[model samples]
Target: MDDTSRIGAAPRRAGDDVIQVHARLRSMILDCTLEPGSKVTQAELSRLTDAGRTPLREALRMLQQEGLVKAELNKRITIAAFDLDKLDCTYAYRISIEAAAIRVTASLLSTAEFDELDRTLVDMGEAIERRDRDEFEGPHRRFHQMLVSHVQEGARARMAIDADWAERVRRFVMQGDQHSLARADAEHREILEACRARDGVRASRLLASHLARSAFYVAAQLEPTYDTILTRTALRMVLGDELAQTAK
Candidate 1:
């Protein structure tokens, strides 16, 4: 039997191999290691992730479900093209993911986790001060991931499953928008303060607005009209009375 049919014949780590390959592939897809909208073959993936073709194909199938890749007419895989038009919705979705995570897990997070979170934020601040995107990106992602990790394993996994895409987009935006990065850092500090106080409501609201601001800013870089109405509606709901007061 080939590797595919022989997986059951192999040890349990064969299944584990599929998962590891999938994670690496997902990271590559999001980090632009594979390049956006570029074609990738199974052989390429096998070589890249150092897995057998069977597990590589398994990883590819999972990625395809996430909308990160698709089979071409020639049977090659194409990295899913990013639609700039979706910026507003992408922004709003990220807010929802983060807001839900914070609300559900704020009280559950251990004090030590909070300290680690604070340290991560401080690292981000230092990276920002030094103008090091590489440094900032790592801590920034860890901060968000740790924020979600306070919840149940399943909840955290679900929250993080699609995060690679957001990371990729953020890298794109941060590369050219230092002003926005500064604003984001200030917002993050506010968020950390709210979390430190154990005020879930304030933390959630601030997070929504903070995310909305980034979404709108990035969307505005595009046509400014595409997905504007939907994003604004979502943000207002997140902002609640604050949005109305701002309008007046």
Candidate 2:
């Protein structure tokens, strides 16, 4: 079906409608097409997605729960801002969860799965060589996901949430420097090699360190962009305040 007809057309099932709307909205947010902290009007969203109010609202609610949208006091909903504090917390939480998941999954990976992961790493290398940012992100995510796929189902779900948060943070970081692109490629290579050796502990440690490095780099880049509330919040939290305050 055409794009217009597809968005307007209702899903075959009620449950599927919610999922489809949520996925589309989430994509817009991650890609910065909707942008952070931008107001979202139900009428406007309905027109944009060509979906009805009910499904749009349902989708917005789901995004809110996922921390991608903020439901304000006056019943207004907007795309959530990139909160450094929350992002920092998420990084910490994810490192713990994903590291554990990867460790467990390493023990369970089959020869075929290992081969697939190796291929994904190869794809990531090519994407980096060509500086294909969009292509790089897909294989980058897949490589990390493969590391944890053999874990318990529940653990994989939790890791997926972590993966989503990481992607958002990566997009933000990419806005500042191309150097991070190279660093990310190198980190993926290290992670894959560790996993291939079945060294769960080493793999987990490397993954955590890799994520921490990315978080630090992004937090550094955000210094000059901090607003008053964010500045104060960073101060109270003793995180990025000094750099933010000095930023011109």
Error of 2 at 158 (Å): 2.4
- Model 2 Cα lDDT, one tens digit per residue, 52-116: 67787788888888888987676567888877777677776766677787788877788998888
> Candidate 2: misplaced stretches above 4 Å?
1-21, 46-54, 72-76, 104-108, 125-138, 223-248
Best candidate, TM-score-wise? Answer: 2
Q: Give the residue spans of candidate 1 off by over 4 A.
A: 1-80, 84-90, 244-248
What clash count does candidate 1 reach?
0
In the range 183-242, model 1's lDDT, one tens digit per residue, is 778888888888878888778878778766655555666545656666566666666867
Work out the TM-score per prediction: 0.66, 0.68
* Candidate 1 to truth, TM: 0.66
